[model samples]
Target: MLENIREKSQGVTAKVILGLVILTFAFAGIGSYTNSVDTSVAQVNDMKITQSDFDKAYQNQRNRMAQQFGEMFDTLSADANYMANFRSSVLENLINEKLIDFATAELAIRVSDERIKQTIREMPEFQVDGKFDNNRYLALINQAGFYQTSDFRDYLRVEMTRRQLNQALIASEFSLPYEEAQLTGLQNQKRDIRFAQISAEQFKASVEVTEQDINDYYQNNQNRFQNQEKVKVNYIALSVDDIADKVEVTAADLEQYYQQNIAKYQQNEQKRFSHILIEIGDDEAAAKAQITDILTKANSGEDFAVLAEEFSADTFSGENGGDLEWIEPGVMDDAFDEAAFALSSVGSISDVVQTDFGFHIIKLTELKPEQIKDFAEVKDEIQQLVSTQKAEDKFFELQQEMARLSFEFPDSLEDAAGAVGGKVQTSDWLTRFGNTAPFDNAKVLDAAFSDIVVKERLNSDIIEVNDSLALVLRTNEYQAANTKPLAEVSEQIKTMLIAEKATEKAQNIAQELLTAFKAGEDVTAQLAAVNASFEVKNDIARFGAELDNNIAKEAFKLPHPVEGTLSASTVTMNNGDLALLEVSAVKEGEPATNSNFAQQHSQQLAQATYKSFIDALRDQAKITRREVVQSSEQF
Candidate 1:
């Protein structure tokens, strides 16, 4: 099962949906990570997943993971094995997409131009006050990493076609009563077990770590104990923090600012609504029947978003689960506006409303009333804004002046600092792999290490850290990269060797105990001789959280005991702890009869059906791979 692969991997359908979502958030300034060489990394039939495509997709996935993990991401990515798996999984997702392309093409699935245009129109991001805005659409596509609207349209065409194919497979899935019962039994299975932890920490104190072991380990792994290249620099810093305090805004200034930006203080009443549109096609009755079924589902407390995405003819809004975002009067068709605005409360649905286009079942998701802030109500905010603007203006002026001085006097930042009424400050040691403090930005590190600043012994140009801060730097001192002295790392090596030896000891003991238990020997007596006891857990469910995660996973993974004999095995843990697992009893749950169980079963089967089809396509596809460079970036 692909479930055994990337943790119940949602498969290529999920990958495409994720790509579509990230495309919306792909701001203009996000740096491109693709290579200049246009080579195929993977191919399906005549179609190729180019290096550029792979790089862009990988960057998107990497960004998602980084956002999810935050500070812990640095530690996870530092592991070469972990990163290698991550890169491979990302490439596999792309390869799966290529296979989908071939399958969809072979099946004659294609998204029409009208569908594409409608989808674009329904997109809430491209709309202003609920009406589709062409200018907003153009600006957003550029921000979403597309230089041309046609390019985005082409990309959307492929994915939407794939979505059509995916939807067909999902809609065709059904779980029979017997299938649901069978799955419920397995899902709710329980195990009664007793396990003894053969912890490595118990053996660590007894494990002998000799001087020779430390020396040998240290000699073989010197790369692990190297002092990375480092540098300290003298820099002239200019920031809004330095300038904003010196600026002042009077009470009259606040009033004038409030009056100048009065539009910003006014908020019009708006409501968020979603609609399922059924166009008046050739068979009007069939269209009405389809919409009636959808309306029934929506009224019965079914997820309106899911219903919208599945059935709405308005492709643009359907893509966002039928959401048109916030809208007031007159933005949409007169009929739609009248029906939607008449809803007095949130989560209320309007009756069928007819327009030239078709019929709509509108759901009022949210409503916000109008607001106006008087001068006194927002005086503090206005003061801060005025001060910030003044500081920004001053920051730009000083940045230009400092840049001119730094270039004219390349040898030192002292003159530049004097010009800006600031002093030259020294940085902590910054390494090639890890930077320190305010100099941690990539641009700052690049400028600090550039040939002009380091080798030529000249000041760097003004590097903008952000909108509020900029700096000019020159190298003060440099240290050559070298291995750390043996004296400094000897104890570290000794500790490592001890841990390794201790793990070995734990494994041996766990294995010996497993043999005794399986052979019906008196292992409990043997274990009691040592200061350890097996913890007993009775009737443990498959996903019970009370047990340790590592142990619980293994407990369910163990095969059932047979012929009145316990199933015994030695399990090695992630933390180098070993466990002697003995399962004494097993129970299969009674067949479930609940409606929720059947519904859950159907959803699971649907996803499985879709993934199985994709996997089959992938297996039959002529896929190829090429060696490409991997990024060596660190957080």
Candidate 2:
């Protein structure tokens, strides 16, 4: 029952609020956000959201949608209006973040440094053997992109403050006794609904759009018919692979390279071992004492594996009988390496050893002697590596030379192409939106239309398309934005008008049928005329699992029927069809205040209360959005 609450809270707005108020992106640290120069895209009161900040958030959301939906995400991008809404939503999230921060400050919500430290210490990810391990904590945050622990602490402090503010607002909300009873009854109520759908398609055969109607509609919405600016260009696409293809390594060169990196061809002696590690935290004495006890047990033949499993701080190896299999001498700590290699006897236990990590008691299991592969065995692999290295070296040299030559010549890409051992290639007309890549690359597209390329007519400075590829382009043709002639788009306009008329007619017919049903008039003839019949559903809960989404949404908007009166309404379905619904019978489910549904709903109420608070903050704040953000909404 409560799962629906989770489902309801996963929308874009809820997710963004959750992300800003909490670190929901990862276990810790926000996504990588950085800027060299501050250029505000928006401002919430005194708080500014820079272009870098907006780009980071927008790109993060875009990437998340792409990941969640895969190819289906492209459908969202395909619609101009949908894309605009998506961009606006991301901007709104940034605004919400600043607004939330502002509210937190006004409320004087503060998280103490000691409390932040305690929170970090209590996190299970940073703990080893039920105790906080600073090394583990540092490694984890660093891996999560918080290179400095202080930065992670600051982030944690801010999130804690926002959470505190929101929580306080939520806790302040209270439903009175009568209000609670009313809400419980309403929430538990079920409805018996009968709906008749009038398909917009059925009326399309009779719909007509006169030429004059089409012409007038087209004249009024001409901006929608205008074309976007486009450009055709001459470009040199240079890639590391092209240079790699030209790199040649002789047999003698491969032989010399192999000898220089001979250690890579030689396999080091491997040791298999078991160990009991006791992590040294603030209480190093306790860790040392524990290791000593475990060491004594192992030497005394009291089940070494059992001792390791129970006492080891390295939980990963501890679970596997402390086995660290077939590791080279230098694979771990320098002290660990020395202790393991010094043991010559198989099945021999070593004394308690001290290292930077902690104390460890080692039991040598087995060893593999060193071996070297024949030159013939690795010749092919060595040749490929040598060739790649040479190609990379040459590519770097040529990349810089190409950039210099492109700028030096300024007007043409031929010199740059020649310098990089590449050829100038022509491109199909690229829209400002970039119909294809390398034109699709943001930097390439930006330069492709910048005044130097489109107006002054100079070769673009070398732009890296990706890690491997670089590009220099010169405009060959430019298409000025223009509106399509009415003659060309008349049919398209006519079809759209016909569809709109048909939908409106369908809605009117649905309303008439609804009126007839309410007046207790015979509607069998009307139903037959439109080829529609009532669909009855019983015991439909608030979850609306048994009903269509749009139909359910419309059905529930009706006020409860009382004194033998019926509740009726009409809604336009997603497909331009209309659903006329009437609730004939209502039954209330048994209310259990302690149920999961009730608890989840209480949380929902709390969120709703918090939302009101944020809304108030938003209304009171001075919000400003710059042009860079506005122009992006069009795409």
* Top-scoring candidate (TM-score): 1
lDDT comparing candidate 2 with the true structure: 0.79
Q: Using lDDT as the measure, which candidate wins? A: 1
Please write out the lDDT profile of model 2 over residues 37-91, one tens digit for every residue.
4578888887788876777778778888979997677655656577778878898
Clash pairs, candidate 2, are: none
* lDDT, model 2, position 592: 43
RMSD of each: 14.4, 14.1
lDDT of 1 by residue, 142-256 (tens): 9988887779989899989989988898888777888888888888888899988777887788889888888888888989998877788999889998899999878888888
How far off is residue 411 in model 1, in Å?
A: 3.2
TM-score of each: 0.62, 0.61
Cα deviation at 458, candidate 2, in Å, is: 2.5
- In model 1, what is the error at residue 616, expressed in angstroms? 5.4
Colliding residue pairs in candidate 1? 119-316
**Residue 60 in model 1: shift from native, Å?**
5.1
